[model samples]
Target: MATLNKSVPLSAYTQFSRAEWAKLSQSTTEILSALEREKLGGIDETISADEVNDIYLPLSQLLYMHMTHSVNLHENVSNFLQKKTKKVPFVIGVAGSVSVGKSTTARLIQALASRWPNSPKVDLITTDGFLYPNAVLEERGLMKRKGFPESYDIGRLIRFLYELKSGYAYIEAPMYSHLTYDILEDTVQKIIEPDVVIVEGINVLQVNKKDRRIPQVFVSDFFDYSIYVDAEEEDIRSWYIERFKLLRNTAFQQSESFFHRYRHLSDTQAYDIAKDIWTTINAINLEKNIRPTRHRADLILKKGAGHRVEAVHLKKM
Candidate 1:
């Protein structure tokens, strides 16, 4: 695992080592059960309780501080205006490259944040749900460019975020299935007014180039706070390969899985295929679309070789 550099001379962000950040958990004692902890991670991730205690608990507490402050600020404005307003969700965006364990980070935040006193509801919806359906991608000849910004229904996504901030009573986000590796038709995740909404995906921090000229609201515009999970490109590639190999014996065996054809591949062949996919598709997407947006985040979680968060970089106001 990488160690934090003590001196970050003349940086725009304040840096914290893992230990330094862990000390920030002065409040919030709510903890997930062992079973709950077991259920908090993504495929091929084993997040130790110590890691949660040393990392996520502080993160959860920090989010609570931000969440309450946002509510207070909203209340103050409403009072000054002498008008009643609907409760708006505090949106948090988690962005990162594929296989960077961002899904786990998002889920951990959602689970821990929801467990705070009085149990505020924290809803999570990934940007994968907004990706153009496989049918649409195929029609547009974007199957090879699936994770790219152009492959998503960016208009619809922007509208959905708009509605959340607009305080819609209930909104339906489209559903996506990893097994089929496509958007599920006629299925949606109905989200009521959640106190916090964590939108996780590689695309969350992106600013579409087309929007620059038109001056349109972006996905991050709706985010009250945003986190970008960072790591070495080669580390993520290795993680991707390991996950791919693991899936060959797991999800790939499912008849309905989009990659079911790869179920019978030998370990060596699986590595080769995974390497090829990562090299040609995922890595390209990360470089061109995802990693470029990391600097835009309010907070960046720098991960080391073992998927450990070695340091934290918080943007200075």
Candidate 2:
């Protein structure tokens, strides 16, 4: 097993210059299979290849290395204790402000990690499935803070992760719909012994201390690694507005979308609406809750105004 000096912090492990960082971030030639590539292509309007290369590829590689070493250590310990070998899944937590590209990061990491020679079966899951339905949020008076910690079914989320890490062969997680903004009743997203699992959400790592009844094993307790995608407040606000405008022009125009009312807006009106949502809702959430988890990440990807990652913060090894 590789030894990470216990006394040394991970941040000091390696310092890459601008060129060096970019070089290290390059993607390998082989990615997903043809069918998977076609499916992922549909999301390209939101996520880009350059972003995947600079952010997700390197992050996934780092996680792979970390997982490999962890497995080796676990095997050594098991042998020392004369215990039987057991399967252990590597869990990665991706957290950030809504519209800060956490979803893109999650998808890219899912694709990249699965391509890793060491970990060939990686699965991606989101905490959206754990969110209360819009009706439930409205009834609970939490409609305004839909992505808040209280808006989640924390018990179910914890149980799912626990089962996955415990080597369950076929674990089921709820399915969530962005168009309906609700959980799909009786539907499940199945997982079958994945080597790596990426769990993405706005508050994946939030620990509630006020509720003494809350168990010590929070949602993030299962993570073997964690990533926080970060950008400046101004940059993120701009990106959010742009994404909202894009959705208004496309997805929001669909009859099935809950926000179809946005389809009637003129370009100028749509821009204003997007700005309003960003400034009033998303911005408030970022400031009040999301950004606070920055220090809790195992790795941090800091993006520039151009939306490309400029620097990386890996917790000292």
Candidate 3:
């Protein structure tokens, strides 16, 4: 098994030049057009095509090359053992603090990779689906720490990824409801043999298991590649509060939403409430669990105060 070498600092990693990024952007015009269409049709939130082009295009291209290299390596290993092995899926993990735009990164990469000629069968599964049910968390007095590492069913999540990595014919993962904020027990999304699978979450790179200094395997151990979205803690906190206010006015007002009661607060009051939640729950999770794993990411998209990706750090291979 291969291990992630941590001797080099993230700053030591090289980045794509502006001209190269532009070229990658131009190459993915089709993807950008589709993304624009979604935004215009009001099906998606308003994020620019330039954002998708400049970031996700280059991101998917790099992932494609990495997946190709991984396949070659797997084949070489099989040859050494004199056994025929199927082409396993390339797993990519996207990790970050709350409101760091990791979801957008994951969705953009999925769309970009799915359109690639070499790897059309791309799939995405969020670790959110594996989060313990709200009832269970409430029972354990962990409702406030919803995004914490212990809030997830790590064993089941690991088993699901293991089966997928082993090239199972059809792997079915549980579905989650954002409105209810709980796992949908009877619902499953079947992923047929995909060439690439993107897994996105808050603690995807967490390795330490609390009681033990090292876990048997890091959650990121299953990943062929991993990306971390990074920003200043203050910037992320502000963004989290802003998003919470938006949700409180819109999504939270929905009858089925778990946070429906928060919608009753006025905008200013809601902002204050959201900030308190951030300072108490999300910030603690970021400091203790999420941020520590930044060093383990294969790449990091460091963001500025405006929530735009400012620097791309590609790990030395």
Top lDDT model? 1
Residue-level lDDT of model 2, residues 1-317, one tens digit each, is 23232133445434443445657755656455555545554332234455555555666677778988888998899989999777678899999887777787787778777777764688889999999878889899998778878899988899999899888989998989887667899999999878888899998878775667655878878998888888788888877777777778788878989888888888789889888878887888787667766667888777766566777777675
Q: Which sequence of candidate numbers ranks them by TM-score, best first? A: 1, 3, 2
Better of 2 and 3 by lDDT: 3
Q: Which pairs clash (backbone N, Cα, C closer than 3 Å) in model 2?
A: 9-316, 9-317, 10-315, 10-316, 10-317, 11-315, 11-316
Predicted structure 3, TM vs. truth: 0.89
Where does candidate 1 stray beyond 4 Å? 1-10, 27-30
The Cα local distance difference test for each model comes to 0.88, 0.77, 0.80
lDDT of 2 at 19: 49
Candidate 1 lDDT over residue span 1-317, tens digit each? 22122223327689999999988876445377777877987787878777788888888888888988988898999999999787699999999999999999999998888888758888999999999989889999999999999999989999999999999989999989999999999999999978789999999888877645576778999999999999888889999999999999999999999999999999999999999999999988987788878878889999988899999989898
**TM-score: the better of candidates 1 and 2:** 1
Error of 3 at 281 (Å): 0.6
